[model samples]
Target: MSKPKDYTLLVIDDELQVRRFTEVSLSPHGYEVHSAESGREGIELGTKLNPDAIILDLGLPDMDGLDVLSSLKSWYQGPIIVLSVRDDEDSIVAALDSGAHDYIRKPFHLGELLARLRLALRNNQANQTSPVYTSGNLSVDLSSRRVTVGEREIKLTVTEFELLKVLIRHRGKVLTHNQILTEVWGPKSVEHIQYLRVYVGHLRQKLEADINKPRLILTEPGVGYRLQNLDLLKEGMTASEAALIAEKVD
Candidate 1:
């Protein structure tokens, strides 16, 4: 089996200690780690190295980290995980809304950072290659427009399926109310958060065994919603069985 370090990683933080610590830690794990201390330098290096993944800091010397993120995301197709001290909901939502794959607060655990990076990479790969998404007992065949829960098929209205499709395309990633509404409804409908909520509720009713405590369609509190990508629970489990396990864990 190939080791995890087969990929390249870029660490963009103004703190020399942070860059060094990340390099020392991830280099031992097989990753080719590179560092940049400023937003402009990070953008330049990111454009040049085209690393498989990025660890970005929100506080940069020359420019805001979010701006750098936007610049990199304009062309970079790989995952970008925001690693910063800003743990507030607004900052987190902004980074994710700007196309970040994941967010990690500063003073973070290295183990948790590694786990999030692995998931981001896995999800990125899966998104590119598969038209079918299976998590737990729920299955969505994007190419076929088919959805199933456990052994039984579930029916969805046109609008509801459109909403669900948006969620599936960005599975495991938070979709802001504006993002979801704009995609499923339209740019003009971005303010129609209520519409988005209703459709999401409709989806949960059909997809979740217990709508009161949903496992699949998750609320990201003040941000938006994320479709749970329970990849680990997907092995031979029925929809009902998956729900039961999820309920227990919840």
Candidate 2:
């Protein structure tokens, strides 16, 4: 296992206390923490450091957090988690749509923040390293275009598979409806959110053990959907090993 020091985290927040708290809390866990007070400075530091992950606040001094997120997403491919006091659903949806990997309301627990950070980093690495994704009883083999739920092979339509590919690629992260539509159907189809819903329902019926209560593909209320990241199966095996086993199984 790689140590946290192998990762560098950038925190973009105007609040001095938030910066200090994040630095003090994460530094001991082997992470290299850096802070920027304004959106411009954050963008500059982000470019200079090219950190593995970023903890961004929606309220920046020079510009709106959404604008900063837009700028970063244009160049940065790493995970960016929005940490802010904005609790409104609109703000959350906007952030997710703007390319945030996750959203955490203010007055958050350090443990939860750490867990989110870990997940974001893990998912990012997994996307780069593996063509297969597994969670719970579900396994998707992107290389072969195969999906299985336990012992049963599940067949999916081309559109359904494309949608599932998007979700699996960003497993554990919230994907806005617009993002999903744009990726799956195209930018012109972004407004067709109902199309996304129907396909998701089809996926649930095929993937979920109980369509009434989905454990894999989860709805993020008014935002979008997230693939639950249950990760590797069994003890002591890495995700790669599990993927290999899943691909080999009948």
- The 10 consecutive residues of candidate 2 with the worst lDDT sum are 241-250
lDDT of 2 by residue, 1-250 (tens): 7454868999999999999999999897768999999999999999999999999999987899999999999999999999999989899989998889999889877766776777778878888887878887788999899999899999999999999999988887889998999999999998899989999999999998889877678787788888866652233345554443223221
- lDDT (CA) for every model shown? 0.83, 0.86
* Cα deviation of 151, candidate 1, in Å: 1.1
Candidate 1 has which clashing residue pairs, if any?
5-30
- After best superposition, candidate 1 residue 205: deviation in angstroms? 1.9
What is the Cα-based TM-score of model 2? 0.87
> Each model's TM-score?
0.86, 0.87
Question: In model 1, which range of ten residues has the least summed lDDT?
Answer: 241-250
RMSD of 2: 6.5
- How many collisions per candidate? 1, 1
Q: After superposition, how far is residue 206 of candidate 2 from its true place, in Å?
A: 1.3
Which portions of model 1 miss their true places by more than 4 Å?
1-4, 232-250
Alpha carbon deviation, residue 183, candidate 1 (Å): 0.5
